[model samples]
Target chain A: MSQELIDAITDMREEDAVAITKKLLDGGASPVAVLDACREAMGIIGMRFETGESFMPELILAGEILAQISAVVKPRMQQGGEDKKLGKIVLGTVQGDIHDIAKDIVGFMLDINGFEVTDLGVDVAPEKFVETVKSTGAKIVGLSGFLTLAFDPMKHTVEALKAAGLTDVKVMIGGGQIDENIRQYTGADAYGKDAMAAVAIAKSWA
Target chain B: MFIRPDNWNQMSPLERRQARLDSWQNAPTPPFVSPEAEKNYRERISRVRKIYDMAPHDRPVADLFMGANEYIVRRKGFVGKDVIYNHAALREPTLEFHREFQPDVSVGAMPYPGKPWDMLDFKTYIWGGQKLPDNLAIQAVEGEYMLASEYKEFAADPTAFWMKKYLPRAYGALGPMAMLPDFPRISESVDTIDLLVPFGLPPFQEMLKKMMEAGNELMRILGEVGQTGAMVVSEGFPGMGFNIVKTPFDYLGDTLRGTKGILMDMYRHPKDLLAATEAYVPVLVNSIVGASDRTNAPCAMYVLHKGADGFMSQAQFEKFYWPTWKQVMLALYEEGITCYLFIEGSYNTRLEYLAEMPEKSLVCHFDKSDMKRVKELLSDKFIIAGNVAASLMSTGTTDQVRAACAELVELFDGKSYIMTHGCYFENTTDDKIRAFIDSVRK
Candidate 1:
């Protein structure tokens, strides 16, 4: 049954995925089992994306399917104490950049891969990232931007984290134009070319 | 000038393309400031033509992909808003940049006329000084202007879709356009009364007034700018971009369906998405051909978005993105207009499909694609330009910029290539741009 759920989600049968999730929950399958199936399906989709068998639309649609499944399963699951999330990470699209699609993808990947992501959303100031890190005790920080204008802000964000005495925080930068040179210029700890890379970086840091 | 023969429709695509190219080359030369200027202009045009013809030429022509926007800012200390709001202020600086840089092609004074946009309450883009800092470039705000279920209606009548659905959603002040009657439904005289009713309404009247006011403001800005292409041409530089056309896929993704919305449409309504994009081919073809004819510059710029490597798989791109866009390009090629495609993102996986375009039909300006691979696959077939990282231009040292430029020129061996930055020169420094242009000149 779980394999069936995974296949349905991986195949991008949106309505079928939702229906199968409900069916599993009703057929004495645990909510945790349903959630596990979702993670497995996402891993398959992410692998396909990395292999070029899939693209952004597949990732996006898979994320949407996961969200729908989570909505169906969240109420049936127990409350809070059994938490086994990998680690905490704060993410944003950096200052002066309003692009959120890539950032949101990174956030979704991190969430599915077991990290607790605090998405600060677009146009986030450096201080906001610093304060979020300080308050949440997240050692991982992801700064996203799709423009060259985001370069200075990324450097500033990295500097701001250090200035706030959060020097041990791991900063990863990615977007449309970012690469190794930009990683060095921004003083980020690492550069991720895509959302899966972001998840891997966060996992390694965690 | 080569007029279309009566048998134009009966001719093969290649024959029609040659006729159009002949028309373009035979168009009368613009008035020049001096004989020396005319001589320089002819030399530049000849060099470009040689590269396009896949023949040996003087040297690799160097042109700015998005023009000298950042150079003007750095040299003149003008903020982004100043460039948009003060149109006349750019004439001297633009001319000065052209004189100093001396690129083979000139993209002169790309002014946005913020006043008109502001007057119209344009919702599509947030320009400098409006929402962002005065120094930053304009950024588009994505929205789902066309809903997923509306694709059938859109494909049925794209003009009505624009007037009744798209325009009102794109322009905040044009909300009354939603009340417009479908013109195709009102063929008879008796049906004319209903069509006229919406125009009589106060809201529709108010929208028309606002549109006229915005139009007038745009005209005023244009008057100040004063035919930038002609002005530049008189000084010995031929212009490259006559007009702009978006790929049908991009027309859907960028304007109507937002990126997320379109991606979903690919799954939920693949047939509708394909139909809608196909519907846009004739619209785009006619618009670009008309613009090219009017400007007498036989080139149209297509900044491709939503069809890059990571955006979709090669199969999806072939199915939904490339076919209709190829139709548009082929239609333009028949009309004698060349397509200048600035392949905005990395097109590593999509290069083979691009190479499938008709020889001499395109000039691919790449951004992040691996140029070595691009040269191997595309250099023999098309006029390829670019892959200088915009990050390197903005943040790297002058020496670094020079090294990157030298590397690309050496790779292309100075043949069938145009030296240019990978993307727009926004946020780049004056010294780096100088290094970029001067490195090639040497």
Candidate 2:
């Protein structure tokens, strides 16, 4: 039954997954089992995305279906005292760059993977980053930008974090043009090529 | 510093160009006003012409490979925020920067509607922090502008479907267009103008006035900036502002059917997707040919988006992408204009298909493709431009930039190659720019 649920999610049968997830839970199937199946399906989706067998729409759909499935299962899990928080992380598109789709994708991926994400949205300032870190206690900071001009703001944000004595916070940058060269230029601790890499970076920091 | 010719300020742009063209065509006694400057200009032109013709003249020729944009504006010490939002303000500073660079070829900016900030959709326009920073390219936030069921309607009458079904859904301002009643016979009679009395009403009048003002502003900006481009050429730089076309699949995928929506359509409505793609071919061909003829430009720029290696499978590309794009290029070639294919992402697997193109008919400017493999395959048949590491130009030292350019020149030497960036980038230093030109020279 759980395998069927996994297949439905991985195959992008959104309606089927939603219906099947409800049926399984109502039939007294484990909420934890249903959630596990969803996570397993996300792994397959992420791998396919990385392999180029899938594209943006598939990733987005998977995120949506999972969110729907999570909505149904989260209450059950909470009632049973089964929720596990991975870690808190703050994510945002850096200043001067309004591109947030990539950042949104990364955030969605992290949330499903059991991270407590505080999304700062797009065009976040350095002060905002520092403040968010202070408030949320998010140890992992994911800064996103898709333009070349994003390098300086990224660098400044990193410098600001260090200046505010948040040097222990792990800062990672991701976007269209980001690479090791940009990572070094921006003073980021590391950089990711895609959402999966962002998840991996957060996990490694944790 | 560039010294303007006599009465330069007095001459209109056309007269100035005609005078310069006359001088170039005639090659009067002494070649130029100053002997040394004449020799230098002649040498540069000769070198560029040799590369353009693929003749046995120069070993490696470097033409300037950038557009005048906020990148150059910021490099010239102006804040991008202040100038990029105002089209009229962009003219002088960008032109002055171009005068300073004085590249072998002047590649001018294509006029997009409104100011840079104003061109974007409202949500992204604000969320993206209004002043466009250098590295950012304009992207529409992904959404389904057309639903899956709308494909049949779209295929039935694309124009009406776009106006009635798509435009309202995509843009908030055009939301009222959805309420417009169909006028099947409005154009059939001259009395329809009088029948359409509501169009002259207050609300409609205000909207019409706003549109007219916007249109007038766009024209003024185009004229002023386009004049700057002509002036660049008049000052002895061969101008290149080729018209770029998107493949129909990309067009549908990008603008109408959102990426996810299109991907769904690919599975659910494969035939509709194919039909829409086929329908777009003539539209693309006509636009390319029409623009080329109108502008008298030699090359048309065909930017291949969403057809990259990983974007779709080889089979999907062969079916959905290559056929129409191939048709567009062949059709353009038939019209005496070759296309410069700015291959945006890795196209390694698709090179075999592209190689089937008519020899010397396309220039491939690679961005993410493996440069060595590209040379091994297509360098013999096509005029290859680049895959220069833009990240290096922005971050690496001049020596690193020179070393990379030297490597590319070595592979592409005299083989109809113009050393250029694989793609445009931000924060590239003047020294690195010089290194690219110098490496090609030496």
Candidate 3:
């Protein structure tokens, strides 16, 4: 069963996902086995990278390969359940600004750790974010705005969320324009300078 | 030049005499500037300064960095210019991709030339419509700052109609306006945070704590894997700044109405392209300063193309960009950081304007500056970094890259140089990247 799980992560094959599922149903493998392999493979690639043995081009391709592999293996590995019903997340970039490279990095890292992120693409309207959070019953909302001009809309989105009666929800802010001072100015519960920081905040959020 | 391979140090009296005489024969003399011509140049600078007063450069706090120099300059460096330029040509509006080769997106370092250490992601895009001839070049520099590599081909990243984007300003010729509100201003506090990182933050303090922890663990294992073929380069520019874009002109792309276009538009509606830069200047510089300082590497370099002099003549650069640059330098310097500006191309036409820059105002990364003259003139003040041409990597064999690297290493010996290509290597083939590293690592 362990060998089978390792094979799936190595190949990043969709067929591996189906087989892993079959094994789970057959009571032959554990979710821990699958997750361990998934994380181990990612660790291998990342280690190769930090040493200058690798550069960005390879990291990107490898990241994609890992993502594809994880998608196939995730559902089965989560083994019919998630760890903490750790409330839902609605994330998107603010309006009039369409930069999300940083946002996407945050999203990927969040997903890696464990967060059900509803990522709205660039130039997202504030109202849509509020509506999505309300409808999905998600308690966490993340907004990203890259421009100072877009700060207005970010503020509007938070106000809209409060107006929509989701006041108790945690609101996290990030991107180039968001900082500890800016977060306070924008009235966000949490803020991070980059994706790695954002994921950590998400992990800590109540 | 002939050399005594065996007895390189041995020299007879006659041979030494001959060598001394030969050196005297080829010794370069300072180029003479006639009194009248020198006067005319000084007058020209005086006139320009009258038109646009030189920006004040305060006693900016400066930091000096010893070279994190690892690779032998006589050894090879990446072939950035060839790959980047070649790929850029492929994406040119009228030009066709050089058929025998296509732009490569993946780059890897192997234990050996034949082995793959791992591949990393390096993304690139071309800005469609460039506003200036050097817009793409500036963008390439910025990429080097942010992402830490200049693999972007010329004209990649912000290309097409995107380059011509001209935003309507609130007013016209309104000398420097107040900074745009809501924009982030750089703070020197980032330096404290950086220095404090090693002390170990509360895992809850910042997410980087966790990432750094993880990275530390990863580095340990990578150390083992690295025992075989070895990495391309052993060290990294931890606090290095990669300039991704040039200035605001390029920021607008083709957005600006030409002088004629603006003149015609002035009559049509007016508020179309007036002075919008005052607000953006601070915001952009703030981002540059903040991002660069955040990295905590005191030796940060910004990629700028106007040649060694500047895109606009000294007067115009001072009138428009210099104040902003000064602001950034001050903010960064306050954090005890030093900066290098990769000044590309020739500034010969406007050398006098750039000549009087304050003592070590900022390091001048020389390109077209007459090396001998600039070496003599600015060597004392600036942290000179490069002048090694990229062709040496592309056309010159590995040995050539080594020789060029050696020359740059030796010539700029005992000084700081962020050894790199004349430009970027967006289209550099795998073979060249391999050879370049092998020859230079020695």
lDDT of 1 by residue, A56-101 (tens): 9998999888888889999999986455899999999998889999
- Docking tier of model 1: it is medium
lDDT of 2 at B124: 23
lDDT of 2 at B351: 88
Cα deviation at B152, candidate 3, in Å, is 15
CA lDDT, every model vs. true structure: 0.84, 0.71, 0.43
Tens-place lDDT per residue, model 3, A18-129, is 4664566467556566666655655553444333343222333334555655565666564455555455788898875556645765565566556788898876888899
**Residues A1-206, model 2: lDDT tens digits:** 49999999988888899999999999999888898898889888878877768766567778778889989887777554646788999999988776666787899888877799999998799999999999999898999987666788899999999999997899999986677878888789999878888888898888
Clashes of 1: 0
Number of the top TM-score candidate: 1
Instruction: Evaluate residue B129 in candidate 3 and report its C-alpha lDDT on the 0 to 100 scale.
Output: 23
What would the per-residue lDDT of candidate 1 be over residues B1-442, giving only the tens digit for each residue? 2467699879876666566655665567668888988898888877777776678986787776464555564467777777768777777777787787776777554668899888888898887889988877688898999989899999988888998899888888989999988777898879989889999999999999998999999998888776665677888887554477799999899999999999988899999999999898888887787777676665688888999988988788889999998888888777767788888879998888888887878888899899999999988878898888888877788999899988988999855988877766566676777777776665
Task: Please give the ranking of all candidate structures by DockQ, highest first, separated by commas.
Answer: 1, 2, 3
Worst 10 residues of 2 chain B by lDDT: B120-129
Candidate 1 runs further than 4 Å off:
B1-31, B227-229
Residue-level lDDT tens digits of model 3 in B315-433? 34444445545555554444333456666555554444445554444456654356666556665555555554433333345555556656655565444333445433222233444
Instruction: Single out the weakest 10-residue window by summed lDDT for candidate 1 chain B.
Output: B65-74
